[model samples]
Target: MAYSADGTRLFSCGTSKDGESYIVEWNESEGAVKRTYQGFHKRSLGVVQFDTTKNRYLAAGDDFSIKFWDMDNVQLLTAIDGDGGLQASPRIRFNKEGSLLAVSGNENVIKVMANSDGLRLLHTFENVSSESSKPAINSLAAAAAATSAAADRSANVVSIQAMNGDARNMVDVKPVITEESNDKSKIWKLTEVSEPSQCRSLRLPENLRVAKISRLIFTNSGNAILALASNAIHLLWKWQRNERNATGKATASLPPQQWQPASGILMTNDAAENNPEEAVPCFALSKNDSYVMSASGGKISLFNMMTFKTMATFMPPPPAATFLAFHPQDNNIIAIGMDDSTIQIYNVRVDEVKSKLKGHSKRITGLAFSNVLNVLVSSGADAQLCVWNTDGWEKQRSKVLPLPQGRPNTAPSDTRVQFHQDQAHFLVVHETQLAIYETTKLECMKQWPVRESSAPITHATFSCDSQLVYASFMDATICVFSSANLRLRCRVNPSAYLPASLSNSNVHPLVIAAHPQEPNMFAVGLSDGGVHIFEPVESEGKWGVAPPAENGSANGAVATPSVGASASEQPQR
Candidate 1:
């Protein structure tokens, strides 16, 4: 069941008592049936959804076919046969704009269709099963059963239930039956019976099992799609838009939009067994888009983005590598945060670790490098922040920040520390609060409570113009804040990009990487292992507003310094 966009009407579908399936529309305010459409599906109804966009249509999927109806007149528009086998209860969802629909069921296929023009078949994604060994095991079991039956005596067959039920009520005597001998005068007694049990055993493969998409959603822009399976999330970018006909209507001849898989997150049971609380795999693209750094299993893989080839691999000692960052101006220099509360500085060109900075007593959680200030900052589980002078490759300062009271002391709650694109300011996010600091002063300028819940902040970044700060939380929201006064700007609920039902499911943003050049464009990495590049539609006068005076204090303002300042100068207190 679903409510219409205006909340004036309601739509629902189900099988009737007489075995007939139907879709009914109801007036929400009056609680009266507005219209009833019946006899559209031969079998039981699977799913029903109302298009909320200008294309006011209703879609219903059943065992064998999907039917489209015009919501205004209650007329059948068209019906498409299911390409795969029976889909008794297929999961269906519409994109945010109601332009496309996705359908999936027990089969290894997901069908994408156009909703505007007669429900045309757009694309079919097949062989998306999570467990590859299931098919082979089924075939092997069938073959084993076929061969095992041939060795059993047909006449000696007896139902186990019949024997067990009646034998307990009978006397302890064996009944005898006679078979005629060749002479006809003599007879042979046959009283013995034999039963053979069939034994079949199968050994499951030890490798990682493939998972099918159990849930799917589109970003609000409809430019990205996310597929969530068992322990992995697959992310794809819509490479093209649907073409329109001469009359400005979407046509069937237009080929399906191309989708490119950007990245995937795979968290297997084994990886979880090792730590039970393993962090999700994360990737970060360099400022120039030349190198891509990915962290998995305590190893960092460096890849050339243009060629998509592995350039080098760096393995940290003891604990796993959790976070990574590249120097804004020099891609060759990479900073890695390790599980053992140490930061390793590596020169990718030389393929060697240049230095290790240790200050925190717990695992390192965040790392960031500022090209303008030539400084590196790191945070760890011990609630301590360590600042390093990149010029001399030495630790400059260490500060122990107060941790939130009554929280467990297992892992570091700090998630990020990032420099603004303009190099004027930096942000340190710990627990639910974000602290903004000036580069020259290195003092906390403004502290804002970023989230209402205790969910830790996962990622934070400044817009390319350095006027706004974007922070993502574990509660599946990206909060936008004004850089000057740290005032709340807006909250972006990514789930709003999905269908109403699926939006309620648990999906959190894990990693966020800003685009090098575009201020409004950035890539968001989800907990399911999906990386989506978001280019939101701009509204009028929405960008770069000055912070409110009531929220900004006099001490929070810092003057920008000239580029020629000496590195040996002490930072202003």
Candidate 2:
């Protein structure tokens, strides 16, 4: 079941005992069926979702096809039957703004469709699971064969030479004969290996053949999609908008047949469990959409999104990685804060631990790497903050920032550390207050008290020019501050821009990412899985705020002072 953007309608799909599947729309408040779109799928219906963007359509999938329905009129808008056969209920997810829809199931392929172009197939990813497995399997086979042959030949020749006089001379003669015999046996082995192929066929493992997609999620920026399958997590990107058809309508055209594996992380233990019903392992994407993270059996793995390379694997004692941070300037360096009260500085290029920092006695809660100051800071539950110099990968300073007056025994909440983009200062945000520190002296410059609220501040980032800072409170409000004096510039509530149905929901902001190049532009991800891109509009020396646009675009019009425009102006998203 899925709720509409405004929460007024609910879309659901289910199969009856007789194998008939149906999709229905319900009026949430009245508890009545608004519309019933029946007999759309021949087999059991497995997936149903509502497109919350301007498209306002409902997509359902079954064994044979995927169907899209207009939410307002209950009309069958389009049905796509070219998906071949979905092994299980197809998993469908929309991009942050609902412009692109990604569908995957038992098959090893993910189909990306464009909503603006009548749900046309924009890109297809094939062999998402087997691409990496193939090479690993072949290498394992070659290594095993080499080891077995070497061991067997060594034993056989030793026995043969042992029975003769002067065993050393016999051993030398055995090699000459074995060399000749090897040449003859090579052809026999090749022919023997191929003989069965002429009469029989090779079959793939059942699990590999039916590796179904268990989870699908889009990054906050809508630049990539994370598909969690049975044995691995697949990162997919390279999205191209659909071309306009002859009728002047955007439609799916044949996309370039070229598709590359963005990156794949192996879940060896999870796959070895061999349970088809088990859930996919837990994984996360970094706030900036630059790194992919996954944890299994107390080990954390990081992958570079751009190159699709495994950046590093960290095995910290006792506690696992609870927080991660990538260096803004040097992608090769990453800081991982573990629950064990230690921070691991990893050099991704060599896949080695550059340093292990220890200062706090309890778990580490937050980590931040400053590009301008070349410093790494970590916060811990032990009421301590540790600062490290990135140049030497050594701890430079440590400060005991204890919990507030009465909350000393409470479990430490997440600590947000951010550096101003202009390299002037940095901020450390704790439970109910934040402190600004000068970059040069690393001295506390000013301390600002955060408004008391049930929801804490989930994210805080400085603007590019270092003039303004934006902090997102879980209460669905973003507080802007003047960087110099930490003065409250304004507080903007994102709920006002959300649909009416979602206003009542606890749709609080989870993350806020500022653009690296554009100071006025930033992105906010909500707890309800929605990403909003905002850009402060500059007009007549005043900042004009505009309504949030689909796909984060401003639509070429700006409103009066409020916040910013949309993600359309930022290059990263």
Candidate 3:
């Protein structure tokens, strides 16, 4: 419905009473329809900016050619007759300067057209991977010149090149961190700047398929790309190369000559080449990037970043497995959370289950190991809380922190208890109250009532130094509060970030996790199979937030904003 350019403009296309299809543009400024153009041979699938500089638009769909339109007049400018280019509806987007428009569809090739009069085929990049029966390019973005903001020093917009297989086939869609997804192409970014004609090829492993990319995050360092897929998470690290004589005022023509090969790093449970069942539902890496803890179907897996292989699997007791966690120390010691409302301590180095502790009446939803004392604290859906000795889980100290009593069967959500960095206090976010408790005395320190419109606190995470606590609301909003007083600090509403398919579900925030290093950055996963990433900004003496959902909507009609390296990169699949 809206695409972010300056703000957002609503776009639509449909048939007129005369049976001919018409393209209409709405001016958000005036809140009215601006103009209409009716020149497409068939129904227009969608409209994308054809020339970013001129603020022009392109309309295409059933026709064999992409129609260019002057946005000011909504008049047909020209149509590039791609007799074979528009077999399937292609998603199109123009680069920052509107110099290049990348289009990809049902075909195996991703075509880049120069925004000249003839719509010149500046480049045609194809997926050479043998795993693909037919390489389908899901999306594409043009690499920015990387020189826009000299002082701030951000790389050019990283284009996200994604793909997937044709629907109707049964493929591996497990939410694991993998290179590709089942029946869909995994999302990847072009590390270098825009080289419209460059066609570097890659070979991908067979049988790996990417369904749809949920989110793509490019690290501030420009050395890594984090891709959240339907079933898994993937990390792509750039292989660094020393710049020989690089100087300032770089030209856009030198992206290809400056970079080296990139490598993929994954912490997956299904590391066995032949195992088909192991997977990674979601995962988080430490600030140091030395450790990665992942949640599989019924187990927690740990991995060493250097080798990219599983070091241990922390499975719960027999027939009651669910989640696991590794202490911040990255020792072989692991904490296991069970579906049967129990916490188990394991000495991974010794390959032994240390102890099983009884605590809550409901399933354990969250577990954290304090770095100060190496103590393990667990929270349950039953609104119960407890702490355990690092040496043994049997040394359980249960504390019934004060909570607003709710009706039976309506208990608090999981992972709402967030321990502060001091390790002396923690915050308990319940359906009706945000309670802060002192760990030493197990006493309620403070409490803040939740606004009626805000969803119950299902998940919460503390900032690095424990200055602030970010909580995800059921109403698709993330509220921030000062850890000192539990006072409201800021809020980010991701209601607009959801894909159209999931937007209407109004599901609770199923998973809320933040990057350990990027304190202002976090991700929210919804029940409707959509994951949204958000980052903080300080524009005018105040903080603001932005979502990665730019063009991503429902029905393959929306698009995610390509702000980072993940936007322009292409994976081997």
Candidate 4:
């Protein structure tokens, strides 16, 4: 059973009717049956969820197959038939972007389906249990304890415990005794570690572990196909990338895909380093992408991106750093946004906070600096955009964001800023709208109302050359506009592209990074943890003949695997 996105409706699977499983939707506030979805299942349904972004649809999976119901039409949209690896109902999940749907029942396998093209099958992957984790004491934990011990007092023996996922099996750990100490509890050195003590390990059933992929990401290059399972990032060759689509067609000749041994990354942050309750990892990359910064409820760590070796660790006191950014001109100068509504200017060169700027009444959501403008602009969930004079870190001015055009009654939130290449003009996003602002005037030069057509607007940015503006909605819709006039040049949705098969996908682009060299080229991050390269395809100009305008003018783009994709990954332009 689950509540609707707005929390006003509740849906649940109940007894079968006429030998078919049925779903009842209840008015959340009054607990009354508002509607029922029927005629889809013959078995007991295990899971039910709503995807209201693009389709007013509710998805449910039973023992034999998974089904979808269009709540808007009160009709069955699609019924996918399969055992779904289940003796019972399968778990169902939709990616936040609402384009990808995952269903799993009993085994390690999961089926991924795309909602864009009549619920076509895109891929299937192995699912692993994230619930169960083994705790092995690390040298980093001993070192962490040693730093505090040495600062307080010198002791021959130190007691430590294995730090696991909040279970904290307290084992009285003594360092290894090289030459037998007078007391057995006394230690010589913390050279090796042991597993947690006196705790029963429980393994979850394979069926229970079914459900979802926790995250998505890119691998070493576009050539590799990576799969994530049980905290491991596996470079899978059997279930390959750009190799074969699930197609949902069965062939008797093909051998079953076999699992292979996989590689993993070292623990980036030890459990001992941060408060588990508040240990949310925050990450930022330096301007050159040479260094990586991470903070997880504790000290901030600056590490080498390639080697993943810790270069430095410094504590940013109380309230924690919610967001981090590097100075455009000086990477060493870090802008740390605090949870308690403050921004600290930390200078790595001198190893001290340069200044603390306070103006926002809430945590900072975005941070951008302009050495050319000699100022820094910050936006916060408190609906405040504050400017700070970088010279002395003085608050210059503050502005409360305006509510959306039709949402005057509801206060707006989630403001962000991005300075144009010139550093004179910047993009400001607040609520369901984006505007251009200049440093001196602080006036909205141009503004456009971003609609919640797909899902709520998630992100927006200016082109590399600052000629185009890009805004992405959560439901896989990307819009491009001319910054000069705010005219919509192109709008790309699930049905936007040619080669009909490619237009509908299981993933939608949410996060984007503009290419450093190409003004019309950028990499868009998909909700499924993959990346797609978007670049403008231009026709050869001997007499100035442009590509078809329907393909989105000269700035029109096609999506493909980025960072050196092979021939197959490159789509036909």
Candidate 5:
């Protein structure tokens, strides 16, 4: 159930015993039905969710069709097309901002539709390619020119679209600079990666027919894109946005598509014949970007960035830690909030639990720490926010932030964030308002109430410089606020505002982290196991593309092949 501002009404959408879907509104006080929107969807899956950005609920069913219901009055707004033909369950997801809805299933195509600004086609990818293509489209030509002189040279341009609807190229583009002499036109090179016989205009790989992409997350800086499948995660793909007219487009060459057997924070079992447990639920990169930590099936494991080896493992806890975060100062220090309403601080240096922190009255949902003050803050389902000063693991200080006089009829959705270096100012999102406070003074600074009558904030974070505060609601809008004055900065659609490769209807970011070194760089982790990194416009006053990491992954292996390997063995662009 969801609540309206002032907690006067509650909203919920569920399937009745007769297998019919409905949106029921109730009075917050007496639990009386205030209103009901019938015919939510046929054969519904009972997993409907609210998107605060759009201020509505997303209802889907086994039929593959998704209906968007307006929350202002709980009415069927629009029904987007789905991929499920008749018997398949619907797989509809709203992008972070509700701008695009991605639907995929038994069909070879993953359809993405731009719902706002007039419905339009965003992209379409083939499910599987029977044969790869020849010397892939290597580059993109400059934008079409208006004059004949420019058209003469720029006629060879081609745009590279991926099978999964990743709008950008799968690899980097190498730009070719030439003189303005002979009617110079920008000629793009499109290099196809898949083999010739299997190339299809819109299909992905046949391997994906049975392989489920459990996660597709972006890095904190928004430069790298990560995808997790049944066997392994395709990590660290870089995208270069060109501005100069003469710059050439180049993409990194990749090896042939095949499954490998390995298991790490980014690895999965590729052999479909072998039954595997569900993929890991949570994954996080360290502040130093040196390791990837993941929690699954009650196990917490850390993998090395360079070797992808299991660096360490903590004591097995009772429940899985769905949310994990690395310490700001020490990569060895990790904070984990579990479904059990407890926070465990693990000391990687000794590979043991240094201390267990607890205070939340309900299950802990989010966790954050401040390096400047060496403190940890957590919020949870219990409707309470708690702060702890980390001295050693076993001994520390603790305090509970004040809350409203009484618990609202329902618990607020899980979302919280601590300010930048200054832990003094933090943001706690309640069902109706975003409360600002100074940790040191232990006083509420101000509250920004959502008068638009949207759902409560689901995800919130502060910029590296503490200049902006962003919060995402069930309405599908990310409301940005100014840290200096607590004023509304702006509301942005994650799909419209986020990097192209990271945009997807099924991708909903649950965690946001700022880059420790770069002021404007940040990374977000999604429920689909996707991570995206975004950088401000003027990083270092120069738009420098992120160089690929020299790890032993596919790209890294090609960059530094083993001895006795012929130079021709290197991946070709």
Candidate 6:
């Protein structure tokens, strides 16, 4: 046992009557043990020494090795030496500066070690078996006996040789007490580390916090993520070459690429004004994915996807652009929906507004082009869907969307319509319901309404293979359904995955994007500027099997019919 320099706390290490070894810290003022350190050694310990220089380290010796510890964390740092390396009466001592240590386990042999790091042997003297002195065979034999007797026992217990009246044992040497033992000195300590209230405050950097994530989309190759923040874009790239492994699978040897402050053009059109409310700004990707166009601040800016640099800026006449869509066959053609209930056809190659067509009676909320049917579909706040011919720009058919039955009518701003991979059918997300419709007849094929008790839908998307449908809710919950039958697959609760800084924040998934190549991968943008990626874990081929929470589900995510699922399907929470 040893008292700290301040004498307020004591560090002790020794063997119990049962031969169980222990190391502990004692708070003398309260007359109670402060902490017990376990799982470092197995045999009884020699005297514990405190480093006077830093007062943040402690070290001790068992029969065969020296153990170093960090007083700050009260945890073992390292243990060094060989079997029966220090025979009989192992004693440890440190120099004035505590940078060097002297340890003796045998009368004839002494070890000089460096304490700069974990105790490293610097020099060895004529200790026991050294050639310069007569080998003390008895001491070596006794140490071997003690070690062999404690086989498979606790490692924290240092094997102490039974007293046999032999001076060759460690009991022969005595610890030399320092002059500081009798002298009192001023104490310097930090809170929780020093006694007598001699505490100091420390300066630390500000903690990082989550920002609101406005939109999320996958790059054309599905190898990267474009996290559209309120005013910037954060890129998360999963780079992979054409290389494959022995199993003929793409080798995932490279870590994903990420940016710190994101790209240089951190400011976007939304930066023009500060709007605290949550809204999905209009953005479009060209057919070839070479460029991205964003509509905000009463104008539209075209950006090169690879460079993220503005290529051109267009100020729409009068009404601001609210939604945008690129023609599926031509990268130069763009269809911009405006607040004036009109669709403006623009030819970027010629830098001109080819034409303007009026159909919707209200502002357009969503627009999508169908390459298979060669037509354009647009939805508006009037709860109407209109189909138009691409060649002549004429309205063909229109249908009224069903009103939100169980919740508030959010169709005006929240309505979303997307075409499936086959382009023969489409999915419409409006209010609290998600419905699949046939593009030919524009009739509803299937529908799933959110439970009234659950949060409203914020964003939804299909899996890469179009076999699964995912819907993100305002509560940070996600429900996956089988696209074929519309039956619930499983529900996901991502709030658990939020960083500690965002755990309690009023955040939820605002948008979701699926990986184009990896069916098991997807990214969800949170209401706060945070992105949660659901990636496939190669070890188990299944998602995390967390402790049951909602209802009785085993995991909190929407993936698939787990290709390796052996357990029963997770129930709804």
RMSD of 5: 26.3
Candidate 2 residue 442 C-alpha distance from true site, Å: 3.8
lDDT tens readout by residue for model 2, 240-313:
33343222211112111112343433333222233324322335565445667764324566766666667666
lDDT of 6 by residue, 1-573 (tens): 454544345665544434455567766434355787654445444322223224555666654676656665556665555234474325676664554455665555654443222121111221332444323443443333333333324442232211121111121112333333222112211111112111111111112233666666776544455655655443434444334422121123333445323455442553334342433367876533466788653468887766667788886435777788888656678898887889999998789988898988877878888765677888887777888888898888889877646534543655778887656788787645677888768888877665555567787887766777767777665555566645554555443455455545667778887766455556677776656666433553322232222332332333333211111223211
How well does candidate 5 score on lDDT at residue 491?
A: 34
Per-residue lDDT for 1-573 in model 4, tens only?
Answer: 444443345565544322345677755334356887766545444323333333356776665655666664467665554323433566666665555555554545554443322122111110111222322223223322432343344232222111111221111112322222222222211111011111111111121121122212222122111222222122121222223533211111122232232333332432224354443334566543346566655677776544456788886456676667787546678998877888989898789988888898877777888655678999887867788887788888877766545565334356778898656778886546667777766667776654434255556777656777766665565655567655454545444321244345545554554533234544454444443444433331111111123233224342321111011111111
- Between prediction 5 and prediction 6, which has the larger lDDT? 6
Worst 10 residues of 3 by lDDT: 165-174
Model 6 alpha-carbon miss at residue 483, Å:
0.8
lDDT of 1: 0.50
* Model 3 misplacement above 4 A: 1-288, 304-308, 311-317, 391-396, 401-406, 409-412, 451-454, 495-509, 517-519, 528-531, 541-573
CA deviation > 4 Å runs, candidate 5: 1-236, 239-280, 392-412, 429-432, 493-573
Between prediction 1 and prediction 6, the one with superior lDDT is 6
Best prediction by lDDT: 6
lDDT of each: 0.50, 0.50, 0.47, 0.49, 0.45, 0.56
* TM-scores of the candidates in the order shown: 0.48, 0.45, 0.47, 0.47, 0.45, 0.54
Error of 1 at 189 (Å): 99
The parts of candidate 1 lying over 4 Å away from their true place are 1-280, 405-411, 450-456, 493-495, 528-547, 551-573
Local error of candidate 4 at residue 235 (angstroms)? 13
As for TM-score, the candidate ahead, 2 or 4, is 4
Off by over 4 Å in 2: 1-298, 304-318, 326-331, 370-374, 391-393, 439-441, 453-455, 536-573
In Å, residue 302's CA in model 2 sits off its true spot by 3.9
Q: After aligning candidate 2 to the native by TM-score, how far in Å is the CA of 410 from where it should be? A: 3.6
Model 3, span 1-573: residue lDDT tens: 323243234455544423355656666434355777656665344332222233345445436556665556565655554324444446565565555555664435544444332122221211222223432321110111111121123231222111111111101111122222322222321112122122111111212344433333333222343444445534333323336313211111122121112344454443322322332244545433455666544356676655666776655324344445666444456676766777766676677877788878877766766655556778777777787776444555777545444545455455456677556677776665667777656677777665444356656766645666666666665565566665453555443454355545665465555543345555554554444444443222222222112233232322222322011111111
Instruction: Give the root-mean-square deviation of each candidate in angstroms.
Output: 29.8, 29.3, 25.5, 29.7, 26.3, 26.2
Model 1: C-alpha RMSD to truth?
29.8
